[model samples]
Target: MFPEPNSELPEDPSAPEEAYLESPHHGFQGDRGAAPVQAAIPAALTIAVSREAGSRGSTIGARVGQKLGWQVYNQELLEYIAQEGTFRQELVENLTPGAGRWVEDRLQELLREQNLSQHPSIINLARLVLTLGAQGEVILIGRGAGCILPRASTLYVRIVAPLPDRVAYMSQWLRLTEEEAAEQVRLRDQRRANFLATHFHRPPGDVYQYDLLLNSSLLGEDLCAALIVQAARAKPGALRGKGL
Candidate 1:
């Protein structure tokens, strides 16, 4: 959909001091104390993403958000869900792709041991994805959001890089040994694949499910974000009623 484009480039509801989340306008204000403006924020546009581990998907998403002046929901989406629901932060954090298979398996075992078959985080995540997607103007990263949202309403993207490249990126980003980064990449990739397969009954890597596939190693994060912004702009309803 992008056809190769050129590269270019918080707050919270919980506290009174945090205005990013709740502020309808004034997103560019230095802080909460800055003078508020009456500018209207752009209406909703949905971007669903699936990414290979260490591909800098989150970084690219952040850049894309900056370009579009929208909010990027990566791990922060999980935090929002935890705050909105009754689940504790620890349990919500444990639900991430970085948690590894053994930890998730152990958590399931503990749940079964207690005879509580349903996990709260799992139950909350799907609903959260759909609700957030519906809200629009949100960049949904990970959590298999590409599979959950309506195909016509969302621009689904998949990010990938060669295994060696991914490992190197992860090692540098996390300051981990090359071997450790490789292990992390492998585990996270498998874990996310399994997550989508188990919950959505679809292979996470199937090409047909996504409208765009990006290689961050080849394009770099900046170009990747530029490409996505271009693609999102091209989508049918993305520019419906606002100045994007």
Candidate 2:
């Protein structure tokens, strides 16, 4: 349905420093490189994990990806979408071997289907999620991904903890003072709430919409990821990747 990522995403040797700062992943695979995803993911399952800031959502999502041999799409989706000019085109162009054209063509189709053309960021984001959803074998973290992915085939999960617990975790992880951590938590929550409202027309922190709701503080990150892996295995319309 879209430009699929390749298993081995080779880095570009001559990419500018700014692209590296923006991508975090291997520099967008240019013509010298191939897609950054597997080829045979047409009918696999997807997991959309939404979590409170500092809840280790990205950490757990990475764990799930490792255990399941899938790709985890994180904040880079939002970052890439936010860019303008050469960067945006560069982002799309770095996918499959010949994906620049294919991605553009498919993206236009999605924009037309959803009747959205105003916000480039939202449109690119929609392109990322929908294409990843169609190909499957993805664990998408944050950015209203749970609300956007096709429900029937996607395992939507929300990970949360008490505000105090999240603050403690963030403080310890980022080496911030407790007061600073608490404020960061509040800010993160408010920002996500606003993003959800503005982009997806949904409220943040709504557990009712998910396939499973997990308390990471209680269950712990490893256990939470294990459970998500188990649940995703059972989701219908999905075939486990080549092995395991």
Return the top candidate by lDDT. 2
Question: Given candidate 2, what's the lDDT at residue 127?
Answer: 62
Off by over 4 Å in 2: 1-42, 81-117, 237-244
Pairs of residues at least 3 apart in sequence or in different chains that clash in candidate 2: 5-37, 6-35, 6-36, 6-37, 7-37
Q: Candidate 1 lDDT, tens digit per residue, 192-234?
A: 8787666656787788888889999999999999999999988
Local distance difference test values of all predictions, in order: 0.72, 0.74
The per-candidate count of clashes, in order, stands at 1, 5
**Candidate 2, poorest ten consecutive residues by summed lDDT:** 235-244
> What's model 2's TM-score?
0.68
